[model samples]
Target: MGIKAALSKPFAAYVHQRNQAWMQQPAQTQQKVFTSLIQKGASTAFGRDHKFKNIQNHADFTQAVPVRDYEGLKPYFERVKKGERDILWPGKPIYFAKTSGTTSGTKYIPISADSISNHINGARDALLAYVYQTGNSTFLDGKLIFLSGSPELDEVSGIKTGRLSGIANHHVPGYLRRNQLPSYQINCLDDWEEKLDAIIGETLHQPMTLISGIPPWVQMYFDRITAKTGKKIKDVFPDFNLFVYGGVNFEPYRAKLFESIGKPIDSIELFPASEGFFAYQNEQDDPGLLLLLNAGIFYEFIPVSEYYNENPRRLRIEEVEVGVNYALVISNNAGLWAYSIGDTVKFTSTRPYKVVVSGRIKHFISAFGEHVIGEEVEKAMHQTMQKFPEVEVVEFTVAPYVSPSAGQSYHEWLVAFAQPPQDLPAFRLELDQQLRQLNVYYDDLITGNILSPLKLTPLPSDAFQKYMKTQGKLGGQNKVPRLSNDRAIADALVKFKVES
Candidate 1:
């Protein structure tokens, strides 16, 4: 047996050991994790102020801490940044993940030493879970290239700061580091185009077997590699069979990415955010990602329909039912207490806790009370694209366009299509119809003449890419918000068209 193949046996065993079904005892397990977090962080100011002293169980903890977003937690985080020790987590955090802010340039999210293990190592554990369940680990023998951001570090709040992917890339164990491509020096260059070129130059001839990255950048890499070699990706790397993706939904990019691949390959969908590696595709048969219950993250759910209520129903694992869209709330070892990360998900399985991300709380347009979200928009795009097989949407975003002229408001959709639709009006009509069916509020708005029919504006090629670059979010793990409240991106799309 080959060295890597021989190692798979034990690795598979370890994955099996870690992922045993504790579904029946989910509440019991979640309560245990919650108790541990409260006790560990009690001495910290956040915990003490929230009266963590009197908290003993779920009800107590819920009443004590309350759910919070990044803004709600910002003041405390700023204190941590100013070299405060044991302020949020015990002692100071080892690093801070720089994530896009709603109101600022960036939000330096604390990354505890334990968070490194919880999400970073949990990512590996998730892969292992796939390997164990599928009994396929031969790819470990060859190269496993990850299109990652630079591990380039900065100091914020006296904490080391960079993208979460960069932080995790730095923590890749010595053993696997040998098989990873693109030297640390090359990745640190900061220019994505330059970094990708360096990666291609270094890895073009390697026996690559597994490729992992966000869908858009990964598609870019595949195209570049194919063009440079004048060969299909499968031909260039015959052993390459696994394509692991996260950060954005793969549905929109699936056809393009698969066309680049030139053959069928095993793929795994993961739900890894800056907050945690919450879930991943474990069984091939199951479409939903299996929630990582034991991975040092305690979870709660609140229905989106009741999000604005004075007191919404906060549900534990035992309380969730299949097919309900719920905003995920998490308490983690990263010193986060009942934090809401703005993402919404729907339960597909309640027993072992499997879910598909539904949308973002902030990334929705509810103007005119239509209540449209990313999932609905994407699904609409999917159905519309089906009618025109030649059309391929590269990237798109929707926003409300309110004019100074009364009764002229409508939702404006800015789309950069790789292959334009045969008839633009037909495409727009199909999308409008699909969205109306998906959202009753949207349907009512259309029927009641509260909003005009959706406006479709075609953008020049690479418009989204250029825009993201200007935002300093050009590459890894960053995605364009599918829906926006204002016309900033739509206006920019107009400027791009004029410039082009």
Candidate 2:
């Protein structure tokens, strides 16, 4: 083995040891750690400036500080935008990670040195868990490919400000950073076209082991790579062992990814956001386990049912019950206090604090997993529609449909079109292909003949927008509900008979 490979194994072992210790800690100890961190973070950021001299528990924290979304943080960001120092955190932040919200134009999320350190450490912990689970530390030896967001710093007000993805690339450990493929396949940095060319040029004969990125973007890269090289991905990265992806669901794209790379389900899904790296798939086979980062932030769980209720009970990490779905609330050092992340999850076990992502409380379809959510479904649709140029979707909604005859259930899609495809039947075929490629569950469901075929209905031009308007939820802060569990919403959509 080479020097770097030899060094990485021992480092991997060290990480595994640290991860084990943290995971083995009792729930009470974890809560204590979380509590101590929150008090420290609150004192450090808002203690002197804001009036929070009376707050105590997690409930007190949430009540003292109203739940703020990305837009709520804008005033603090304005100071940073003006090049002021120590606007949110104690020190001048090194850079900003630009991300988008459903309504907010673009969020320039600050990344302090401490925040960066937290992310790197969390990533290391995740990597070590992978090593322990897989029994393959050599997976770290090969060149790692990140199907990352555009790395180009956007030119704002004649000043170059790094986008979130680019800033993340910059902050990666220097050792691993050196082994990264050239800026080409890196996706969307400033010079996108040139970067694509560089990625194509460099990975011509390299031994890549790990591939990481959002699912849709990764598939896009694979398509581009296939077109350029005239070889399937398997031929290019024969030794690739692990695929680490975040910012979306891997279920939809699982089949396509594995088929393209000719690998098993050796993939890891990370639950990270522009705000912080929340959780990661500790075991490749398991969906993902929430490893509460007690050091960086304090976490709270509000029962999913309480989202609409005014008096929702907030549970600390220690108080959360297994098998129950809850919305995650976080208070991180970045100055977001008791912020609702909008995603929902359920605890599978409380000992090691393992959890499964139930769904986004704000984003859900039917009870079945068929209700695709943000990153996963978008990637699937993009992949499926790539074959058809004439078809363009302005908006879409998915709902559960149970066949009247056989009582078989499946997901039915309602798409509002910008333009209709010439061949509707062919479009359906393409959509099926895309869904199969995006998620193995759907593929397996189809192959097993357990679920009925996905049904697609085309809607009128202004149907989605009009519906949102009728609900008094048009434009800013309101998004077209992508997935809905409520049968009432589906019934309303069909009852209107609003075109396709």
Candidate 3:
């Protein structure tokens, strides 16, 4: 009935119809998208190096370009940072997303003109798809809150450089900017704690209908609001209905979030990264987001099973099969050619090429050759919470303890709890047992006495948050690593250990 809803209805219909067609011939859509990108950037340095002119087919393209990671692409990025035009894209990138993970200390990822469109339009389509499907369009009539990074962009050789949140913040259209909560002045406060305080002060009494943020920061906001007003989140924002979150798995945080809301609401899972907006959940019931075939990003999959092989197979969209774990690779309009984005995924629907995030290639516990992954660890936690409904995980990270400390080397878990299990030892045992079920290599490691049983360490009350804060990674897309290759992060958490 609202003006925004009335207008968006047709737009949503258009998107749904187009998506249906795209799904019918996923390979053809992908071919057209990628061919266009190749032609567009043929004169650029990367394209020339890879002989894109001769790449008439996927086979030729594969032979021409070797896969690369951030470090492998660093040389080109260095030239880009110096304002070189046609070094990657035809012209200079409009901005760069500055980020760091446990693996890469710092990365300045380019965002081309086409890449900006992909991100902004992809986000709009994802939201509209949900609105159209659920027949609930009133959320846009009221205020929308996005817990995001500082919008203050610093110039790098005349190109904007900042967090991806800041990059996104800069692109909100004027009309939507009017409905967005927390004035621009407050949204660009720079410091996470300071920005949260400003956000609380500005919008606590406003009529907010939608909120989007990573789960950890959103949890922090919910807790603070509950403490401040003595009301559940649903009561505080009576019209709140839509919650959009990504960046980390939402399973562990689901129970706690709903408990804070005091009601069920529709949620959307997104699969985006510093490189590109890869996929979005179009259906309410379907857990997998459609691997967008026409998003100006070419898709490739390296089976994690063969990722370490001397001659690992790189499978394209048509070549991928359902139920296989793959390290996702993308060559996008952003000029990142044959780049490995690091996150792993599994195909849930091959017809439309839909996928669910499986884990990360670098994020695992393989210190004892067990090779336990994020998916396994997450499932273990999910089961742990299931068996003991009284306990809820606030945040947790696991690292392989390969040291002979006290003559026992095992998996070390650093956990902070909102409400802990009644029997902590039983909870630890169940988690370890679940991992044994999830992975045979891990079970073999235990059976062969190569590694001891998992170790459980109860972190101080707010240790995860405190540790993240200390690392300057407390909000807006920064996440604590769930699994570390070494005790570097675990040792840091030990310092914040709650002496039980």
The number of the candidate with the highest lDDT is 3
| Candidate 1, 1-500: lDDT as tens digits | 35875687688787676567555567777878887888888999888898888988788877877788888898898899899888887888999888887665687878788777876766787677777877788887888888888888889766889888899888887767888877888878788888888899989889998999999888879878988999889999999988888878778888778878899888999898888888888877787998877777889899988877888888898899888889999988888888888899999987788999888988899877878989999999888888888887778889998766555788988888877888889999998998999999988887877777898888875888888888777878788889998878778766665233
Candidate maximizing TM-score? 3
lDDT of each: 0.84, 0.65, 0.88
| TM-score against truth, every candidate | 0.96, 0.72, 0.98
By summed lDDT, which 10 consecutive residues of candidate 1 come out lowest? 491-500
Please write out the lDDT profile of model 3 over residues 409-431, one tens digit for every residue.
89999888888889999999999
Clashes of each: 1, 18, 0
lDDT (10s digit) by residue, model 2, range 1-500: 66666676677778767666666765655567556545555444344445455666655666667666667767767776776655465655666766555568767776666667667676666777777667676666778877555566765433346655566676677778766765533455334345545676777678888777765446656757877877778887888777777754445455555656655747777776667777877876666475655546667788976766877887777788887778888766665666787888788777678776656766865344553554455655677666765565656667777665453777777776656678877787777678777667777777777677677777764576567657644322134556766555566666444443
TM-score of 1: 0.96
Q: Which candidate would rank higher by lDDT, 2 or 3?
A: 3
Stretches of candidate 1 exceeding 4 Å from the true structure: 404-407, 498-500
Residue 373, model 1: lDDT of: 87
Q: What pairs collide in candidate 1?
A: 81-157
**Model 3 CA deviation exceeding 4 Å by range:** 405-407
